[model samples]
Target: MSIRANLDVVHERIARACLKSGRDPAEVTLVAVSKTFPLERLQAAADQGQMVFGENKAQELDEKATAWTSSDVEWHFIGHLQRNKAPVVARHADVFHALDSVRLARALDRRLEEENRTLRCLVQVNVSGEQSKFGLDPSALAPFLEEVAQFERLRIEGLMTLAAPTDDPEHVRPQFSLLRSLLSTPAPGGNTRLRALSMGMSGDFEVAIEEGATHVRVGSAIFGNRSYQ
Candidate 1:
């Protein structure tokens, strides 16, 4: 299928899922995951009025940020961020989606302070209990939040997670539910604005949306298989 055709199907699925979940179709934002895809594909999506593009690598995003500097695209960093690379990420990303630990958050916070800027980030939760994933376990979220909430440069927008991939939807549902439950936990001082849930992708975004995903990361569903430069 063509890129546009894929996008059409994905949008249709999102709409249907929204209907089932009693959510407004317009309320669910589609973030095209452009990681490892060509710049032409990104331009094509832009032509189709896609404003948000997510990338998984700091170097890749830095290159895109330079090449597509003229385009009005909202770049989101949606990969596991090492503390050492936080400064580079701070330079270009509009939003950081995989902020899993307070240490990394503090690193970015320090960089933002030097750059005189603030960043919007999601606290990535490892709801699947996957040791391979880089995210805070649900139990550690409160202390992590408390630690990072002190930073003036970082704004905690919401939570994000990658459900462990499984063919059966039932296996993934708990991961999604755990994320949703964590979001409902009221923060101290009622200042935590947990509005965004960056979950799901091409394979399971519909389930993710039905469970309360405000932002879904879709790549292959829209762009098909990515071709490297």
Candidate 2:
């Protein structure tokens, strides 16, 4: 299917999921995962009014950020960000979706401070305890945020997680639920700024939305299968 048609289907699914959960569809932001896709495909989606795009690589994101000058487009860095690439990501990304470590945060913070800009970020949680996944343990979120709060250039917007891969989305619903619960937890000040839940992707975004995902990163479903080397 064409990108526009795919987007239509995805949006419809999101709306249906929201209806089932008794939530507003507007509350969910679709981050079209454009990582590894060609510029033409990305442009195709952009032409269809897709404003938010997610990239899993810092270099790819920077290249796209440089090419797409539209103020309407939001670049989200959703991959495992390394300290060395922090400068590129800090300069380009409107939001960082997989902030999983203090060391990486410090690196990004320093770069953002140099540019004199704040980067909105989501703390990634290893809800499924997968060794292959890169995220902070669920128990470490508060302390991680405490340390991250000291970095004036970083804004702790919310949480993100990749549910364990499964053919049945229901199998990973608990991971999504755990993330939602974490987002609702009040900070020490009795109020929480963590309103964003950057969970979900092409395969299981509908389930993620029902479990309270504020931002869903969708790839293949919209762009088709990625041409990986």
Candidate 3:
């Protein structure tokens, strides 16, 4: 299937999921995960009306951002960001999805301040308690949010998480639900109205959408399998 065809199917699935959950389809944003894919593939999706693209590596994101100058094309840095690469991400990404530490948050905040820009960020949580995943533990989320609030340039948009990889999508439902439940817990400074849940990937996005995912990151479903050189 073509990228456009795959995107159409994904959109249809999202709509059905939203209908099942009594939510508006507009509440969900499809972030095509373009990480490890070529720029031409991204451009192909863009031509099909895809505006938001996610990259896992800061260097790849920077290179793509440098090449695609369209104001309509919004880039999201959805990888485990390193502190040293904060400057590149701060300069080019419209949204940072894997903010897991206060130290990284402080680093990104400083860089955003230097660039004179404010970035919308989602605090990533390791809901499945997977040792291999990169996110804050559930118990540490509230304090992390409190500390994150101190950064003026980084707007705390909401939460993000990668469900433990499993063949059955039902196995990951609880993880998504847990992340949703944490959003309502009041932060230290009484700011707890988070509006986005950046959960779900190509395989489990439908389930994530049903469980209240505002943003879904889909890669292979849209662009097909990635090629690692």
TM-score against native, each model: 0.94, 0.96, 0.97
Which regions of candidate 3 deviate over 4 angstroms? 188-193
TM-score of structure candidate 3: 0.97
Mark the regions of model 1 whose C-alpha exceeds 4 Å error after superposition: 189-191, 227-229
> Which residue pairs does candidate 2 place in steric collision?
none
Residue-wise lDDT of candidate 3 within 7-53, one digit each (tens)? 99999999999999999999999999998888899889999999999
Worst 10 residues of 2 by lDDT: 184-193
Q: Give the Å error, residue 84, model 2.
A: 0.4
> For model 2, how does the per-residue alpha-carbon lDDT over 1-229 read when each residue is reduced to its tens digit?
9999999999999999999999999999999999998888988999999988899888898888888767778889999988999999989999999998889989998999899888888999999999999998989988777777677788888999999999999999999999989976555432226989999888898899999999999999999997789
User: After aligning candidate 2 to the native by TM-score, how far in Å is the CA of 191 from where it should be?
Assistant: 12
| Candidates sorted on TM-score, descending | 3, 2, 1
Candidate with the greatest lDDT versus the true structure? 3
Model 1: how far residue 203 lies from native, Å: 0.7
Give the per-residue lDDT digits (tens) of candidate 1, residues 101-198: 77887799899989888888898989988789888888888887777778888888899999998887667977888899898766653325788899
